[model samples]
Target: MSKVIEIQDSQFNDEVVKANETVLAYFWAPWCGPCRLVSPSVSWVAENYSDRLKVVKLEVDASPDSVATCKVEGVPALRIFKDGNMISSHEGAIGKQGLQDFVESAV
Candidate 1:
């Protein structure tokens, strides 16, 4: 099973922003092709780095509040959060290695 947690706008604050540990928030939409392409890498990160990172996914269409709050203008957006603040973000379909590097850089 995938380790990534599916979150909605209502849960964003409590689940991510208020979390004590580092967070990886993935923003995507059901119709976004690039989102599908990048999903495996996200899942890989969730499984491999579960000890250090809290991985969560928010559907763009379903979670408009979160999308706007994070300034996510595109699908497959990955935002790294620490201490209730966004530390880094990338908008696109980054491959497995690239995703790994991205997460590593933050955590």
Candidate 2:
């Protein structure tokens, strides 16, 4: 199976901040149209890069506690982490290609 992770406030530090592998995260609110539209692309990349990366989807509304701690100011934001450090990110729906490119380069 693919290695995309679903993280919550209880597991944020250990699962995300302290992760040994590259973590690719999407911060999206439930009502975001573009987030829904580009979700398939995120899933595709997650599956495609399963061997090299860890993908995650964080529901901003559901995880308000994490949102505040992580300073996630916008919906549909992408954050890339490797070696327990945030390396890159972008706002809005970056589509599959854009996301794939960013994550691929992040590692």
Candidate 3:
């Protein structure tokens, strides 16, 4: 499977909450500045947690319906899921350290 998976509005229901293990979903958009800044950190955490966590990216601009459901107030919202349930979510850009911590706890 691919290292990074893109989850759109259509796939959100089936891929996210129903996932088998932990999920680090990055709700982002191309026009968002903070989203761009923290993307690499997200990717790094995803790679590091590959065995226990699943990371998916959702482009907010491309998925208005999904964004509405998430009710994201800002860019780069990181939601951690465990046992197919959202355990916690970190809003805004947490950079590398925060991302690593969130993923570590989720997994």
Candidate 4:
């Protein structure tokens, strides 16, 4: 099983921005109800799509600077990055199928 990498502000640039592979970042806050609802699907995507995508989890509360830089206005936001640039983003909780589609479309 693949693990969702926990990202912090300090390493945001090195981990996500300059990542060698396509990255899917799940930006969430612990207090957000919707974020909790999307957790499992995020994990599933991490494990299932490990071959082609790099999955990471970022806590908005802990990584404030990174969140601000990403311009994330809400929790449960998913962003896809490739070649050091954000390629796509989705704001809201979604199911496994939706996550698969999100990643597939970006790739």
Looking at model 4, which ten-residue stretch has the lowest summed lDDT? Answer: 1-10
User: Could you say which candidate leads in TM-score?
Assistant: 1
Task: Name the top lDDT candidate.
Answer: 1
Q: What are the Cα lDDT values of the candidates?
A: 0.95, 0.79, 0.81, 0.90
Steric clashes per prediction: 0, 0, 0, 0
lDDT of candidate 4 over 1-107, digit per residue (tens): 54799989998999999999999999999899999889999888888878888889999999999889888999899999999999999998887788889989987
Better of 1 and 2 by TM-score: 1
Candidate closer to the true structure by TM-score (higher is better), 2 or 4: 4
Q: Choose 2 or 3, whichever is better by lDDT.
A: 3
Model 2, stretches more than 4 Å misplaced? 1-3
TM-score of each: 0.98, 0.89, 0.90, 0.94
Q: Relative to the unseen true structure, what is the C-alpha lDDT of residue 83 in candidate 3, on a scale of 0 to 100?
A: 70
lDDT of 1 by residue, 1-107 (tens): 99999999999999999999999999988899999999988999999999999999999999999999999998889999999999999998899999999999999
